[model samples]
Target: MDMKIMRAIELGKTYRDGEKETEVLRQINLEIEEGEFVTIAGPSGSGKSTLLGLLAGLDKPTTGQVFIGENEITSLNENLLAKIRGKMLGFVFQSFNLIPTLNTLENIELPLFLNKIHDVNRAKELIDLVGLSHRSKHYPNQLSGGEQQRVAIARALVCDPPIILADEPTGNLDSRNSKTVIDLLVNLSAEKSKTVIVVTHDLDFAQKAKRVIHINDGRIQ
Candidate 1:
């Protein structure tokens, strides 16, 4: 039986500007089981990324709770939440977010180094997994948009986290590259048994997921 890896109950998020307050998410109740490939799809400015941030423990919600496994992350302090994120969540951003000076291998291994661990073999394995063995020595500027995104994915997996949260991973890619990124993400869930969740505005890409959660005007539809 699959375990519940993530959950959100009546989740809500709001931002304030002086006397004005804007709500981004409203009463969001969601759950994701282990190894499930789920896509959160919505139109522009639909709070998809905000929801992702909350799920990733990168932001605080205005109301409700978020859980990862048995941990109620919404109630944890910053240090504790950061630890949970480090151990359980891996995030891939729309911008790739690779270091410009580091080679592919170093960039992917950054997380391990931060934890005072050094294992070049593990980094090599991810490079091969992402089909970037030939370009492992290349820097960010030397890679194409797709290649950079692949590198980002490899970096996200360096810690071997169970859940991958990608926000608009294919946003900057062409059709072929977009397909490549999606294929890699899907394969991670299928072959690696990782719980994968992606946020995207592209409807066709959203369709590739086994399940899609559509959001509009801060509500799930």
Candidate 2:
């Protein structure tokens, strides 16, 4: 049998506060095929984001393993994880985390710079794709919330990573903006054959995905 593009086997996560231990995720067994668009829906503090982080190698799991393509991410060190993240994963957070001082062009270029690819034209193309070409010179503070979020999307796509893990991407948007962003994400993922994993509490948003994995109290149901 062929190995899946991504896999999580008996995954678990725990956090400690003072003398207490809080178990966040328990025995998460998942497999993601290449080019799949998957979503995880759960209530707050149900470990949805925690799963994303572990899968993306942004955080370490207390037990079990996570694999991206053929790479066992949990076996790698932090430096290796950073390299893998640069080459394989993209993330979109609910906060639309953009640097306030950078203009659209500069913000989109940040990822490329981190990867040491000096290509300004690539950044311009992403700005155009996200419908922010006209705002290329505008700072994040100058753009509307929706526009800023679009810029964030552009930044995430700049590296052309194969996997995109988005956490509540549209949570801060209005209805129309939410639709616009979600539609753009779906379209982009399909066009690029990217694996898109979104975590959201919105039933309508989750339903649009090819597969929706429901989570309650840290276990997939």
Candidate 3:
């Protein structure tokens, strides 16, 4: 049998605001094989992003478990989870979370720098892959929204993690740029054999995935 890179068993999340409780996700059971391209789609408050966070080990589920490979992440502490995330997962956010002061190349290299990995060649390759080689020296504020997002994608791939979790990657781009970013992500899974799970609202983009998981009211539909 093929390896399952990510799995969620009866996963759930709840938030408390004083006397009230909000159930964001409930009984989300899922399994993603290595190199699969999966898209999670839903309305704004459907808990897609919340599920992404739990899968990435950025947040613990309120109930049940999340497994990345053989490790049960819900039981791990923050430090260990951070280490696992750095080594096993890459993340891209909707807002280009690039450092304003850092140039494109620098922002792409930041993750490696934090992990004490000195790999300039790998960083350059990712920049080239994202077609941002010409703009490598530009700062985030100096680039257009599309350019910044490309830089963010390059940064996510710098670590070359087996799995990439992208939250509304094209939410800030125009139709043209959105297609570009989505195509790149598809190539990452098909050509490079990376497991990619994306949370998106775009039906057109969701249709490109190998599997589309629709969630509504915190439950899979």
Candidate 4:
């Protein structure tokens, strides 16, 4: 049996401001098998990114449970959640949030340093894997958009996390770079046996997933 790497049960999220409340996701139940590539697709304002954040343990659900491997993360405190996230999840954002002062190698190794692990070898391996080895000494401002995003992907993988969550990873790239990023993400699951989940509004990108979960109005459609 394939391991159920990630699961969400009756998940929901709502934001409250003053007396107004806005419910974004509701009763979203999902399961992702180990080594599977999945995409959550929906129109803008349909809560796709919200769901991704929840599953990544970056945000807490207003109601329900989320399981990453055997850990039910919905109720884990910030410190515990951070610990689990560091060990099990790698996230790539559409914005490619690389530090301005850090070079590609430094950025990739940041996660390792955060965990008190000093392994330049692992960081270099990831940079090479992402084809950024030559640009290791280049700062974020010194690289092109595609290169920068690649660095972000390498940084995400440097920790050797089992699962990767990307939110609209191709949103900032041209067609060619988008294809490159998509191919890398696909290979992570197909070849590396890592569970990869992406939240994207682009139909083309969503189609790349082995399983596409269509979400609309906070519910799976």
Candidate 5:
């Protein structure tokens, strides 16, 4: 099997405000293989999220290369990147980021709708996998934080992307909810043979991963 899911070579990200420049990540090199569950942990001001964005092709690096499978994401334009992202990656955000007006079922089906996959059965299966079948008709606003996040997870997995990128996925949930989401994420990755990379400030969450990378002061420690 082709084991390489993502690779970063000398990756760097810098932010500019007025005359000052902030270096977020510098000379970072990493590799994530297929079927791996890896967590990146760092301090609040560290570059965990920045690195995640780069790895997901959400943001471009100031310097270096990012390869997703056989494609060089750094060299691709936004249109091409978006296409690749749609086909190969899924994302879970801290805020859940669901459309306010859409119900759980509709929210989970949005990606498929966008990609023109009109399979309601597939979407229902994802909801069942997240154990949210009963809440499928509830809107994001009507559900609890955990329920909303579960809907987010169902949405993310609906596409069945080989790579899942989660940024503080459990940040807004309570302890029990956090555990539920984390366990579901881990189980999904293992069962589906997906590559999972999460950026989080929670050490416990990091420890749950098969491999953990510590980032501090813009470098992997």
Candidate 6:
């Protein structure tokens, strides 16, 4: 049987503003196997990103448990959660969160540097893998949106984390660029055997995944 890399049980989240309470997510149960490509699809206000945050250990659920591999992340302290995130999870944001001052290679190497790991050769290989070897020295401002997103993708893979969570990864790109980025993500899951989860509203993009999870009103559909 394939290993279950991520699982959420009875997950829920609520926001409190003064005396008002807003429930964003409720009873979200999910399981993702290693090396599987999965997409969470929903319309606006459907809580897709909120669920991704919980899965990535970026936020705590108000109700149940989240297991990443063998660890129940919901019970881990912030420090330990940070360690888990750095070692086992890679995140790609919709904004392509690249450092403007760092060149392509430097941006990709930043994660390793933060982890106190020096592996320039690995970084170079990732650049090549993403087909961005020629733009290694170019800054984020110097690259096009697609190139910037590619750099972001390469950076996310530098640590070789087993799980990758992308939140609306193609939200900022045109159709052509969106297709390229989605293809790259799919290839990552297939060729590298990475467990990839993407939160997106684009049905066409979500269709590329091995599994599509439709979420509405914070419930799995």
The candidate that wins on TM-score is: 3
State the displacement of the C-alpha of residue 179, model 5, in Å, after optimal TM-score superposition: 0.9
Task: List the global CA lDDT of all models.
Answer: 0.92, 0.89, 0.91, 0.90, 0.90, 0.91
Candidate 4 wrong stretches, greater than 4 Å: none
Counting only residues 3 or more apart in sequence or on different chains, how many pairs clash (N, Cα, C under 3 Å) in candidate 2? Answer: 0
lDDT (tens digit, per residue) of candidate 5 on 46-147:
988889899989899999999999999999988899889989999999999999999999999999987777776999999898899899889888999999
1-221 per-residue lDDT for model 1 (tens digits): 43799999999999999999999999999989999999998889889999999999899999999999999999999889878888898999999999999999999999988756667699999999999999999999999999999999999998899999999999999999998899899888999999999998766667778899999999999
lDDT of 6 by residue, 50-82 (tens): 999999988889999999999999999888998
Q: What clash pairs does model 4 have?
A: none
lDDT of 3 at 19: 97
TM-score of every model versus the real structure? 0.95, 0.96, 0.97, 0.96, 0.96, 0.96
Candidate 5: misplaced stretches above 4 Å? Answer: none
lDDT of 3 by residue, 102-166 (tens): 99989999999988898769889998999988998999989999999999998888988999999
When 2 and 3 are scored with lDDT, the better candidate is 3
Q: Where does the lowest 10-residue lDDT sum fall in candidate 1?
A: 111-120
Steric collisions counted per model:
0, 0, 0, 0, 0, 0
Of the candidates numbered 5 and 6, which has the greater lDDT value? 6
> Could you tell which candidate, 1 or 5, scores higher by TM-score?
5
List the lowest-lDDT window of 10 residues for candidate 3. 201-210
User: Where in model 6 is the C-alpha error above 4 Å?
Assistant: none
Cα lDDT for residue 97, model 6?
87
Worst 10 residues of 5 by lDDT: 199-208
| Candidate 3 residue pairs in backbone clash | none
